[model samples]
Target: MNNPTRTIISRRSRPAKEPLSKDIIVKTALELLKSEGSSGLSMRKIAKALDTGPSSLYVYVTNHQELSAFVLDAGMESVVLSNEEGVSWEIRLYETLHSYLTVLMEFPGVAGLALNTIPIGPHSLALTEYILERLHEAGIHSTSAAWGLDLLMLYASSVAFEQASRAENGTTLQAISASYRSLNDKQYPMIASLQSELITSDGEERFRWGLEAILQGILQRQSKFGI
Candidate 1:
């Protein structure tokens, strides 16, 4: 029995950091986003910018995708989602979409974050829920209500991406319009005809048109459902 003695050892495993905290990692990543835009925000670069080992960042963010999500969530916090005084869904919808556009525009790198994905995180879900609730109040059916929100997100994000792309390419709205005008009329006649109107609008006007079109679709559904 005395010969059956044993020794025990203990070990510790550290868990990773969550990037949700408003701290140096997030701050540095945002600075990188501002300086380099979406493509430029890499883990290694962010680590370098923050003067930390890349592995530390890995503990918090798995990759650029996660980083993008984090950025969009944090950036979207700037959006104010609420009703205008006694406003109808049409007007409320307009105000909401406008606020969303302003939020993404605030951090120009943000639109790139939400380009095509169905956002499901807490922040994104909150906004989506708000939009759907408004649509439901507008008498839109559940199916159309869901799709309308999708369309609105796509249109606003796409426009924001386009504006960011043009700015990156050193093109102005006027220059873009002029370039459109230069296209051959023999082909793309519709585009050529509408080219001026197309490029002449700042992103805000374009966003309003898109938002209104989506709202009209919602209204069509609303009328059908209301009856």
Candidate 2:
């Protein structure tokens, strides 16, 4: 053999293998998002995690935002929407909301991605379909129900993101919960009055309460409009 023609092999000299499927690429990207948190994930990082070049990821996902959408949808899949509650959209919505929140809680940083991306992926569309079905069951009109579900979904995801941001920024729910009891009575009467009960809520009960308020508001609208 005549010593290596060149000290290094250029990328153009390599042969292309089978491309990675979008599913595998998306899955690996999501795992990387979970490991490094949304702020820390990047195409290069994802490619490195998948043992491929950054350009390979683009062959599947367009970019980080697209990848983020996929991650949110993946997280949404963990949400269980049971129709066992029958036509009680309120109950079904309630349970579904809690379950969705639970999934976000399990993947701390993932919620923030949902907040920013807003689930435009196939999986996210499935979630939108689920929510619309609930609104329809609750007697909401097509027009109102469409936008109403959108707002509700955005709110839920945003709240989860806020919680995650706070946690990552050095303010955990536990610490915030503890601080609630020490509120200044003179400055904030309501918070001070219900501070203990309020802070004691570990996102679950608070989310349920918020969901109830939304369902009740929806029901009120239906009653008022005679829908």
Candidate 3:
């Protein structure tokens, strides 16, 4: 009799016969982004990873820009919006934004890609819808709420890009602090006086502080205009 266990093992170890689809290309591209940064990711590298040629990758993705967009959207697939009810919009917004940040930051170069790409993918649209819905529920006027989405996304993406770029450049907060401390006090007395406050905050602390400030400004505008 044939050994069923050996057959199962062989099947499990078999390589895929058809793996050149768009999904497979995007998945492999994301892995390339992780191993090598944005500058390092190329069609040639992805093709090599898949045991194919660079020309073959163009059949799935037109070019590097399109591939980058796909990678960014794939990274966003991990952000699961919470369903816990009875929470205030402020809390919901905070949690959602944090979750979104968490997802982007997990992929080193993907965050930087968000700066240029228009978010039209399925997951990106879902995130935009959820953010706008929360802002509307929080008493923001239609005009303000719509604009707030733009500002919120720009802020989050820019922050993530900055963090990622600094990491790639081997820069640290301590080095920034030292640079600030070395500034000519006479030329920048105000910055010199507040040096400690400017450079003392860690990444998470600084991010939370700025996020709270932006949210407070939005709430204040609503109250001021009675929207």
Candidate 4:
């Protein structure tokens, strides 16, 4: 029998992998986060997805925490900082926050990251500056504006995390309604009485109400304390 012939292939025939950079790494991390939620953000998982060793990722990102900060800011790239002429500061603020909430809802994993990560990236800084500017226009300055920024971001992040968690775990409003229904009126009079209002409104109404309340409270406090 004749020996089988072998075909030799040149290594150059294969396409070159894209050069790794901080931007590429962050983009890949964001993609993983979107597809697999928070679990997909690990260095090993990202490296595996990029067809490289986990150690290679360290060349750009120092650690998982830093990588998380990058991913969170990258995800926020879509948040619109609208500056339409004739738009009131309050309207612009609400629009910007709504855009942020929408982005978080779209990429639920990033919502969790936003809550945990102290974002120092350019995009994050831009967001902070924009919010501060809006607060200044609203006559909230100094300590009040600074603290109000924290409160606003925190509220949005917390709401997104909670809604995402519930959606992921199949915890529907119906489930909450049933739970509320089972509560005894005598034992929890206030909760039982307000159960309908508690679970009734769509998320939008509640989110807007929360934002309005926060803005009002901030203004009231600023005026009263002169801070």
Best by TM-score: 4
lDDT (C-alpha) at residue 92 in model 2: 77
Model 1, 167: alpha-carbon shift in Å? 2.3
Score candidate 4 by TM-score against the native: 0.94
The deviation in Å at residue 15 for candidate 3 is 4.9
Q: Output the better candidate (2/4) by lDDT.
A: 4
Per residue, candidate 2 scores C-alpha lDDT tens digits across 70-104 of 77787677788767834566777777777776678
Alpha carbon deviation, residue 185, candidate 4 (Å): 1.7
Q: Write one digit per residue (lDDT tens) for candidate 3, span 135-224.
A: 878787766777778888888888887877777778998899899988999999999999888767657778777777887787788788
> TM-scores, in order shown?
0.77, 0.78, 0.83, 0.94
lDDT (CA) for every model shown?
A: 0.72, 0.75, 0.81, 0.91
Candidate 3 has an lDDT of: 0.81
Runs in model 3 deviating more than 4 A are 1-18, 219-227
Model 1 residue runs over 4 Å out of place are: 1-23, 117-121, 186-192, 221-227
Q: Candidates sorted by TM-score, descending order? A: 4, 3, 2, 1
Best by lDDT: 4
Q: How far is candidate 4 from the true structure (C-alpha RMSD, Å)?
A: 1.7
**lDDT of candidate 1 over 152-185, digit per residue (tens):** 8888887777766667777777776777778899
